[model samples]
Target chain A: MAKTIEEINEKIKAGKAVVVTAEEIIDLVKQKGTKKAAQEVDVVTTGTFSPMCSSGAYFNIGHTKPRIKLGGGRAYLNDVPAYTGFAATDILIGANALPDDDPRNRVHPGEFNYGGGHVIEELVSGKDIRLVATAYGTDCYPRKKLETWINIRDLNQAVLFNLRNAYQNYNVAVNLSDRTIYTYMGVLKPDLGNINYSSAGQLSPLLNDPYYKTIGIGTKIFLGGGIGFVAWQGTQHAPNVLRSDNGVPRRGAGTLAVIGDLKQMKPRWLIGTSMLGYGCTITVGIGVPIPILSEEILKYTAVSDEDIFAPVVDYSGAYPQMKSDILGEVSYAQLKSGMITIQGKEVPTASLSSYPRAVEIANLLKEWILSGKFQLTKPVAPLPGVESGITFKPLKERPIED
Target chain B: MVVSKRIVLHFPRRVVERPIVYRLVKDYDLEFNILKAFFTPEEEGLMVLELSGEQTDYDKGINYLTKAGVRIQSLSQDVIRNEERCTHCGACVTICPTGAFELDPLTRRINFYNEKCVACVLCIKACPPRAMEVHF
Candidate 1:
């Protein structure tokens, strides 16, 4: 049997919809079978909470007193540079942007305690932010210098517009070098002292909808603890990749570009993160509700940690050189068990993503649907899938003349 | 009763040259394991070590250190995890040498055991949220 999103929305409106988290749907399918579970369940909510380097926010801070033209000017939010190339009073702050005085890697294993991400988190938390700008004088907007304190509530508009997020899968990073190395994957101890992986696995949004069956452009979702929408197929969207028999990508594949109103988001879900020796980013919480339109879709949603696998890649050499070399592949079940055996050596594993927070976000999204406060939307268009023959490519460095 | 306690000793510049930790073993009959020590000539010094001895001897050893003008504090007081900032990502669990962090099997939340922490400060950098802080 098959169901339509409209039918599911009708049930949600009538308070008759049956909703469960992606984790719960696994056991449900095991007990009731895919066919029965699909018929019985209306929605399966998936979640992931992890540091995404591609995230950032843009804001319109409203016109300044006497009008300062900031479109082509320099702007700093809490001493971190922001892109002011848009309109006057509008600025974009990337999560990875660092302050001018940040020593960065000059001091080995630098402490990037604060950056643009921290500024965003502070703004969302309703704290005052110091805005400093220097503009070239203009005829219509003649003000040259401006410095003020702004809050999210007083901003004309604040929106989180991430270019790429919700990675389908990622590599498990380990160091095989002689000494410890720091990376975006956190610190990797020497000789595989510890393994670090970041992904929600079965509970991940894109993993459940691996083929982009339902999740696509304009699909409403829970972003940073607020209602948001998938804007487009994310940057570096590589759908053509190795997959297990269950259709889940075996490596980092599809991604989503999400957008949401920053005013509605909570600071808890949008947290500032500083990776020692690496840089700063934000940990964003996102949840996507999958409507069980068919038994096949339900079966995909039932994918568990045991069936999901991630490649273990050495960060010291292969990762830095962009070589596709993997030490081994391990299941999320094994990774989550705290230990994984690679090269016949028992290695302890850790997760950069918060599973407990992912569960909470999924449950919260389920509650929103059950209370009729949220509704599932049919995607306006589908993301390029395996059939599209789209493959992610690396940059080709060439001579300027060529 | 025998007890093992990790403590930090602060040496003022006047007593910087004194061999204070050696007296804990010779005079008080306590076993000391120095975890970290830093001192410059004619300057203040600091040492973190775990001392194990009989309760009476341990008290006497601490008393002797106080008489020597060396400030004493618990080693656990040096490093701390900010509970409000911690998201329980388990990044500190595997990196901790003493297994001071554990993820609850049922709740999947991180449970920190400060008593087991040796204050190695490995978790201070590993934590993504910068939750682990070192006061020293």
Candidate 2:
């Protein structure tokens, strides 16, 4: 029997008729339990949606103004803190890169010699918003000592406190475990001109030569592992940069563990969970210059890993979505296709391009659509440039080997 | 189930004193008493105490600390919102488990009455425009 809108909504809202069937639900409940039903829904929906949309992008479950988007990659596994220190450090850098040059860039008062970090500000043409990051300081320790310092309980408290201070200042936070960072370790010995993106017409001593200039906007320079770009050397500094990665510029041995930490650590105080394993670092780097010519110059390094499951702030840009189920059961049938709609009406989903959780949510939405269950309304007038932001390729599904 | 005999009220890192008639009330095995406590807000991470005692004991407790020139007042809600940054996105309106915020249907914004606020800051996380200011 064809179900009416009232009937379907009633069945769905009342939990009378199960969508997938009793046996499937029973099998899923047995395999993953009640807690994992939503996750299993994710896996199924993601598979169904890949053909419909792009990776790292989504038109949010219920609305469209701020398109639900995804960023970073999965890093922590099994509570075993991977990139524990590295994750915190990325937040430090990511927070520092805010458009506003706030003095609270450094986490610790005395940690960095300089008060303000180096800034990288780029206005990518046709891009949604300005991309920027600043570094307050750069200090290198034997990685072992760095790890040990992070493990100490008191030291950990102090670091979190200081990181919180930094986050508060920048109005940003980090999701430590679910942050996906692409790390390049032991990739360069600092001996080769291969990395020298300088636009010197003639090749001389690559290291000692201050004449080294990066390629202008037109020329293409190769970044190993299929990542190549017309790399332009930004403002240079005389400081000694680390250079000990394997020859494979992209496939360095070290792990770039993506964490779930928010770039801003303000959320930590409310969460009752004891922060056991978290680490951070903030390094000063010259702003990578974007060519006035092209947006394609924005290259994705092999270290580029996308985080598909982190919550993002609303269009207002204050905080991520709160965990309360404030919006009751708005049926999947009411979702519209082209216009990002919420509650059967089109509204901004907030540009979620930089959000880490948009992909997962979008995938869920697509599955709900494909099942022939939703009443989708396509926008009468298509939103300009909205379609281009969706990344088509998704990360290959991680197979669960029996 | 563990019965909680006492609870420590830190009182915003401040010290205060009061000598008033009080009674220890048992609400579901948890004992709560209104008594004079000491707090010094000037010092960071200071402790505030609430004593469970009789009228004479309360007087004695107040007398013990009154000489120290402690101020006394009812606990006030911590003001977390920064007036300058608050765009009032109605996030706090949706997040407050208590009906602390009432939206102006005309403006589509929130009116925060702190008396009703439980200080949960769920709205702080929900305010994506970066509006919620936390004094804490």
Candidate 3:
């Protein structure tokens, strides 16, 4: 029995939709099989809340008093650098942008605090931030310097227009070096002591919709606390990465660069952060709904942690080179168990990605979709596909070990 | 009783010559695990240690260090989270070894149970909001 989007929409309209989270849909498909589950289920919600480094927000702060025509000025938002290159009162903040005077090198991870990501979090939380800008005085709107505290409420337009985020799957990091290493994947101890991987696992948006069928441009999504849309193909949107038998990518593949209104966002869904010696990053709670239009789609949504595999990379070295020595393939189940044996030593594993929060986001999105409170947009365009060519080879040519 | 606690041991250059940790183990009959220890170029030292022993012995061990002029501060005083700064995103809930941070389930918010925390300092870095803080 095959399902169709039209029938699913009807079910949703009549308040008779059978919606299940990606995790629950897996069990449903396993018990009832894909055909039956596909016919019975209307929608499956998928979510991932992780520190996406490729995230940023654009703010049109509107005009300042005396209207500064600051063609080029130095702008600081709560001591963090803001991209004030453009005219008007517009500023862009990258998620990884660190404050000019960040004390990251001086202290350890927890103490070296605020950065651009933190500024975003504070804005989302409705907290005020010191906004300062200085420019060479222009005759049109001669105001050389202006300083004021601003909040999200006062901004004309505050929207999250990230270039890339929500990776299909990512590398698991471990350090083989002798000293402690600080990375975006948290602090890795010397000699492969601890392993850290970041992804929401089964609940991740890309994992649930592997081929980018239901998650393309214009798709309405849960961005932070509010509804958002996939504006365009994400940067480095690679779809040709090598895959396992189930179509799940073995490495980083398929990404979504999402956009959403800042006014509608809730503080709890977006947070800013600074890592010791690693700069800044923001954790975003994103949820996308995959309509169960057919048995094929249902099966895709049913992919679980045990079925998904990723390569462990040594971030202690540079990339492309890290691709040369693949540190064995392991499933999300193995990674989540908190331990993996590498080089005959028991290495503890930790996920920078939050599975608990991912599940919560999925469940919340499920309720939102089922209640007909959210609009599900059809894709305006498909993401990049296999035609683009795989960036690197993975898995297939594994040198048969002894 | 084999109870355990986390403490920071500071060794000023003047006290660096003293046998502070050795006496705690041998004389006070306490077990210690050094989470991390660092010596500055000036010879000042700061060590994060987990000390365990009978309740009376642990107290005596800590007292002995205070009298030796070795500053000791509890882990609870060092590892803290600013509730206002936290988004309750639960990023720390998954990385926490001792279940100190957990999901409320009903509210679906991450809650902090500081009592169960081991202060391994893992959550401090894992936290995306930078909400879980460590005070020196």
Candidate 4:
């Protein structure tokens, strides 16, 4: 018997909803079968905590006494440059933005101590941030320069609008070259010394709903330790990709563009990270609950680490050149075991994503649903799925022609 | 009574030219391994040494250095792992040369054994959250 989201909400309102985490659902379906488990479980919560580089926030700083027109001027938050091409007092800051004095990669493995991501985290933590803006004197707004300290509570609006996040699946990065290399995936030692991967595996949101059956635009989720929603299909979202026997994607595929009120978020869930030689990025914690509307949806939620596989890519040659060659494929189970055999040699593995934190977020979301503090919402529309016939395109470099 | 200790010796400028380490082996009958040493002609000299001998002899050797105006500090507490900042992401588990980091099988949490750490400082950069810090 299939259930509707409306019915699930009614059960949640009455405090009778049967909520389980993605980790728990794996065993539940195995013991009780999909048919019986689907009838019993109302929602399965999923979570991931990893570095999401394509994230940022927009803030509407209140107009100053003289009202500086910052739209055509320049603005900076904590010495980090912000995009001020919008209306006066409105500015956007990306997670990867660095200060003018940041040494960056000039020192080989640069230490990005602070950046836009740190500003966002400090803002969410209610710390006062220094805002500096310069503009040309105008009639309506004659202030040439203005500097002030602003807090999230004082801002007219602060919204976390990420372009891409919550990657469905990603590659396991390794190095085949004789020299050590530093990348966004972490440091890869020479001669396949170590492997680094970024994914929550079975507890990931999109992996639990491979085909986007229950996840889509306007889907409510736990973002940065606060309530948020899926705004759209994230940038570089490629649903049409190679898949395993099950519906899970074999490589990096689906992604989500999420939005939420930055004022309600916590600093712990949104951390500022410095990737050795790769500059800076923000580590975001996101949790999406999959409503079990049918047995198939329930089965998808039961996907385990052993069933999910990620391709091992050599970052030295293939990734830098945008080549499609891969070394081999390894399962999450093998990765979690702390070792995997690659090219006839046993290699150690590490994860950039925090699995323990992912589990905590999933359990917190489940508690919210069970206590009736949170309710599920049906997506207003579906995302482009496998049948969309969308192929991820590479950049075609062309010279300027008159 | 035999014991081994890794200690950092700071030689004051006045005693920089003295053979303080030679006395540990010749007079105190202790085995010494110098891990790192930096010295200038007229400046303070610094040396990280691992010394092993009888507990009484080790204590005497340290006393002899202290009397010579050389400051001694333990090397065990140099590298520190801040518990609040660590997310247990396991990035340090693989990069650490001495296997100082261990991931618990059940909890998936990283256990940092500072005793096994050689203060190589590799985990300092490998850690994304900057949880690992070296005081020296």
Best by lDDT: 1
Better of 3 and 4 by DockQ: 4
Once fitted onto the true fold, the runs of candidate 4 whose alpha carbons sit more than 4 angstroms away are: B13-17, B36-46
**Against the true structure, what is every candidate's RMSD?**
1.3, 24.4, 6.4, 1.5
Model 4 residue A158 distance off true place after TM-score fit, in angstroms: 1.3
Q: If ranked by TM-score, best first, what sequence of candidates would result?
A: 1, 4, 3, 2
Model 1, runs deviating above 4 Å: none
User: Fnat of candidate 3, please?
Assistant: 0.23
Q: How does candidate 1 fare on TM-score?
A: 0.98
User: Candidates sorted by DockQ, descending order?
Assistant: 4, 1, 3, 2
lDDT of 3 by residue, A173-244 (tens): 888778877777777777887788888788899988888877788888999988999988787778887788
Q: Which ten contiguous residues of candidate 1 chain A have the minimum total lDDT?
A: A60-69
Docking class of 1: high
Considering DockQ, which of the candidate structures 1 and 3 is the better prediction for this target?
1
Query: Per-prediction TM-score, please?
Result: 0.98, 0.25, 0.82, 0.97
User: Which model, 2 or 4, shows the larger lDDT?
Assistant: 4
- Better by lDDT, candidate 4 or 1: 1
Candidate 3: C-alpha RMSD after superposition:
6.4
Candidate 1 per-residue lDDT over residues A1-402, each given as its tens digit: 899999999999999999999999999988998889989999999999999999999999888778998999999999999999999889999999999999999989988999989999999999999999999988889999998998999998999999999999999999999999999999888998999999999899999999999999999999999999999999999999999999999999999999999999999999999998999999999999999999999999999999999999999999999999999889999999988888889999999999999999999999999999999999999999999998899999987893
| Local error of candidate 1 at residue A325 (angstroms) | 1.7
- What lDDT score is found at residue A151 in candidate 4? 91
